[model samples]
Target: MYISNVTIKNYRGFNNLKIKLSKLTVIIGENDTGKTNFLRALSLPLSNNSLDYNQKRLSVPDINSNCIKIFYKSIIEDEDQEIQLKKIPKVSVTIQFKDVKDFYETEIVHKWLTDADGEPCYEIRYDYKPKNDLDLLLNVKDMLKDCNASEESKWFTLPVEHYEYQIISSNNEKQISFNDLKHVVINTIPAERDDFSDSNSMKANNILTKLLVNTLDDSEKNNINSAYTEFFAAIEKTDTFKKILSSDADFENLKDYINQIECIPNLPNLRNILSNITLGYGDDFLYQKGLGERNLVFIFLLFAFYKSTQKSFNLCCIEEPESHLSINNLKLATDFIYKSVNKSNRLLQTILTTHNPTVINKLKINNVVAFNGTEAISLTDVSQNLLDYLRKRPNFDILKLLFADKVILVEGPSEEMLINTFIQTKVNSLNNVEVISIGHKGYKTFLDIWLRINKNNSAKKIGVVRDFDNQQKAKEDHDVYDAENENIVVRTTKEYTLEDDFVRAGDNCKILSELFGTEIDYDTVAQSMKANKTGGMLKICDAMLSPDKTFDLVLPSHIMEIVEKLK
Candidate 1:
């Protein structure tokens, strides 16, 4: 089953909100930003509210008990306007099952605790008065009557029991859990503290136990070690895994145990003993490994566990995947996650949070989700050209001025020359100013790279510019080009040669190009613009612009004309 959407109201810091979650949703926010609260709400099973706290494991029991109430909504209809039209104040959730078994079991169960007047319990807290409570009681009673009578009323008022499914944990100050209300498994990786042991199996256990599901005999008191041992055996066959865990007596026992279960192949080699084997490092063996290696282990372990469980759809949420990795290693991690999700033709959603711009640049544009405050902004909204410029010029920091801004993206040299001149002379006081060159290459490659970079960072001002070529076409057909338009700003130039028009029309390229002289050819003019002394671009432009014959050689006016146009 896949979770499509979640609507939360008056839950924790979220007063009233709706979010359409992606398969891989990377919830991003600073500390105390309510991201955890959002996770807890989604992780709750539809039947959770009806059960007493002690009846089952709540992924976030403290939250379930402490928060007065919570609301959940999901898009149920594939193409039903009635469902879409039904908006806020009415909450709903829908889950789509891949198998017939799940489809039959899927149901919408709502949980609400309201006063007689229909006001939610928490809402009444702020404006609790004798009159308000009386009115609320009446409203809730009417709502309850409607629920009892309506055919579509699968909704459950609070203090009602349905099913038990959710996991919550309190280790240190950090809390973690998995709720089934929206079919999302939320895992809050615990941060290490001074009192924590070097190899605290907290996070690893929480995740593996759920992933193993039936395979893990949780009814036993010592299933943790056995579960981990099984998970390790599942992936140990691959050579990549063996190098991480050498031969050991305990490993042999775990492998023998796994062989008995038939989930993994038996390995009788002296080296193939333990299931969960890790390289030992100084005093703190667990913390000593490089972050990249650790991240790799984490991702591989996750996939292995999921594969072992045979779950077709998985929503994998990770935080700061790049926390301790180098750029190269980060790239590897990215590839692994992408490949794993897309492999076996199964649907696996991987969502992660990061502040690293380079990582954003490497991802597919649409896959990148950027966050500012609590808002999840879409990067696809930016123009393709602008995205291209930022990708090529990765060092350029444009995050501060991307939104509500005017951005100009151009190809190198000629396009830059023409547009800079035009903007300076034609466009008056551009509100938020930004200019970028995606490179002199074809517009398609430029657009592709740009979108990839900008897609993940929504706060980038993006635009595109392409050459007229010989056809004098702003945007043309190129079989070699891949990016298709609707996102470019095309500009046509009439010239025999690609570089000719701008080179000929300048004081350098700017001045004459600005005039748009009919007879000028930039290539012809550029030849004469070269400076005799310094042999540099600025000098060449200055010499052409100068009135006096400063240079020893006397070049013709047409030759000096292009250089003079440059700014």
Candidate 2:
């Protein structure tokens, strides 16, 4: 079974967040946006750890409610025996917490429902309460009543304040011990993973140790122990050991004091010794490698172990995999994760949270989830054709566009390069604003994508800067020419293009001659500019911003307007 969707309410920063998950989901957002919380929610249900439904886990805005609910939609195989018996196509698990008037009454309620393919299915509810002295008295009274020999059955009542597990199912409701659902395993690689730490080294060792231990049967273990005993006995008979004992005075004294001592080996002891041995390259241990390489190795090692031990279903949730990784390593790690999940023989699902642009750029856009502090917007909600168009563009960094506080969409590299310089000079910083070049056409398609994203995240400010080309017909047909949206600003040049606007705003001859490394007349420069707009604009913008040059250069009012909008 794989989780198809998750809903979290009043947990951490999420008031009510629901998101559809994929086989490989990549979550990206700013810090403290609940990216980690989302991962925790997914693992909480399947994990063996107890839930602490305290003030810290409650959303501050809804603290008075004192309830947190996490719901999951798990897609199960229809042919599975358990699913067939339950007569359902999917499984739904709901974990809820309710804070009663007294702290003693606080309890966790686990509810399981089977999705009967559009029909009503069975629902099972398990309520777990804390244990106390009051529970013991109620148990004795209930036992007496069951025997039907109670003289004061009316005088004794079942206590409400007690540890209890009551399972209410469609067939019957009764008190039963807590039982976990089968065939589900959830593992999480938290955000604070440290590869060089001693604890992390032991964790890696433990994973390998567990895998090795589980793979060997009793017969194999016995064979290993017998081999170890023979090896030890052979070592004792070797001339090297005899020579050392005969030559060393200390050995003779120890042997005299001990009378007799023998080196014996067991399977467990040998396994322990081997588990403590670190794998390395030549003289350097694995932990001694570079941080990024060590992290990658650790992840792959753990993943291999996890895959080997899989039962029926597994979920691997990793947070901030970009941590301690360089851009090249980040790309490699993402590719590795993607391929691992897509392996034909592996029944594995992966959820990754990352902030690296290289990682985001390498993933399928449809699998990306952008968290905006309170809500999550998946790129799958976008038109597939638009995403396909974006995927075809090899240079576009969509993460920058999605995560930036404000975005400036230009036409091509020349505008993208020049506008970045212009904005840096005007604003003294480009930290909050991102400049993206979308080429000349497809402005509307790109704008629509941003518009959908903006609808979900209202805090983003987007500005589109394009040229009018001085064609009346083109101006009339420009989709965003005079368009206005709440969070989006569109600005177009007043002249034929950016080149014509530059010529109109300042001295064309002086700018062109200084930029192109030649003295050319105004008509000659204009002809050249028209012939090669991008090349002319690059030279023009560069010369205007050059340190050795000084001129009365006035930016077009519209260009300055878009810059201000972005600011």
Candidate 3:
């Protein structure tokens, strides 16, 4: 079974978010936009206390600040709105598992199944709320009301004092312990884990423990336990312990005061000793390796551990796997991850968050989820041909469009080059504005994404720039999306193309005339620009931005509209 969807409410960095996941999900978002929190959300319902150590007890700081503020606001508003105990906000997370076809998966989720007969799916939910006692809830509300009336506001102290966190199966709303869900294994390797100093040994130990889980099996562990038994006997057979026992006769009178107590090597459990195992690489230990090599080793170890161990379901979540690696190695790492997930058993699934563009190339667009703090937009329904077109060209940094507050998408390289030059030289500094080229007829897909991620958000603007091969169809394209979308401004060229519009825009032809340093007419320049679009546009851009001419460059009206909107 694999995670199909994740819903989070009032968790850290999110008021609410829901994203549909795939087998190999590549989450991309700017810093603090819920990419890291989305990975951490899985730890709530699918954690194994023996494995994951980042699982600290939930506290007030873990609650979303907005939810706390709203709770207080509801308590103070008019004093007549009947605030029920159930209406109090709760910080929660839900993970839904799908495709339970095999016996192993079915047995694990049978108790958690919402529907045992239909296409099988299961949900496990976690909630942090005040206890479900009616009298205690009433007392909690009274405390809040008293605090509100006396003006002694209890900051950062509302949810923790009276709240308890619980895990419940959605099938029958029955509470379950972490041990009950031991069949699910999830290991999250953080980004900053290369430091192996004494102070950072916890991080170092975490990586090693995960590696050991991949390296050792049940039989190997049993063999080690038996070997430890024999090894401890050998140490006890030495003369040191016999000397202490033989001296009992000499201290017979002292023995009456302090019975017979023998000194021996006192060690903890076998697993504790194994946890102290040190790995060496070359001359130094594994943790002592350089950053890039150590990180690559971590990836290899996680991959090995994820596939080696058998479980009902297995998941590996990584944050910024591209940390401290060269571009060439990043590509290899991404390719390795993609192929490993593809070739492994159906039980193995991997989810990772990355800021590096190369990490998404091999993973493809369909498996990527763009998280924007409050919502998630995925490319699951986008055309395969378009997704492949972007994947084949790594030069196209699609994450820029996802991260930008304002964007303008063009048809090809010519429009991209010309528009960027114009924006930089003329429009001053639009720091959050970006220009992306997605070829022709690719606006609908990204626009649909923009509409989803930016819905109910602040007025983040996006412009669509394309050529009008036919002017009548161009107006239809502009009017349809422009009227339907408040965040989008679709601007198509009035003439046949941007080049044709440039030839017709006032005094713009003179710049092109000076580009070749020849007496070329406007119509011929337009025709030649069409024949060689990128090269012709490059020369035009060079003349305009780095000019040796008397007059300034004048942008075409259609192009000016977009530039003006950007400004």
Among these predictions, the greatest lDDT belongs to 3
Predictions in order: lDDT: 0.41, 0.58, 0.73
Q: Candidates ranked by lDDT, best first?
A: 3, 2, 1
Candidate 1 residue-wise lDDT at 136: 36
Listed in order, each prediction's TM-score against the native is 0.44, 0.71, 0.84
What is candidate 3's lDDT per residue for 260-343, written digit by digit as tens?
554333574555657766666788876666778777776776667667767548888888989998877787788788888888
Candidate 2 ranges with C-alpha deviation above 4 Å: 48-113, 116-179, 196-201, 216-222, 229-274, 326-328, 344-346, 427-431, 456-458, 469-484, 506-524, 532-534
Candidate 2 residue lDDT tens string, 1-75:
345666664444556677767778899878888888777555534432111121112122322122211100111
Better of 1 and 2 by lDDT: 2
- Residue-by-residue lDDT tens digits, candidate 1, 312-392: 344445556666677777778767766665563333445565555554555444455444434444444456665666667
**Backbone clashes in model 3, listed as residue pairs:** none
User: Which of the numbered candidates is closest to the native, going by highest TM-score?
Assistant: 3
Candidate 3: count the clashes: 0
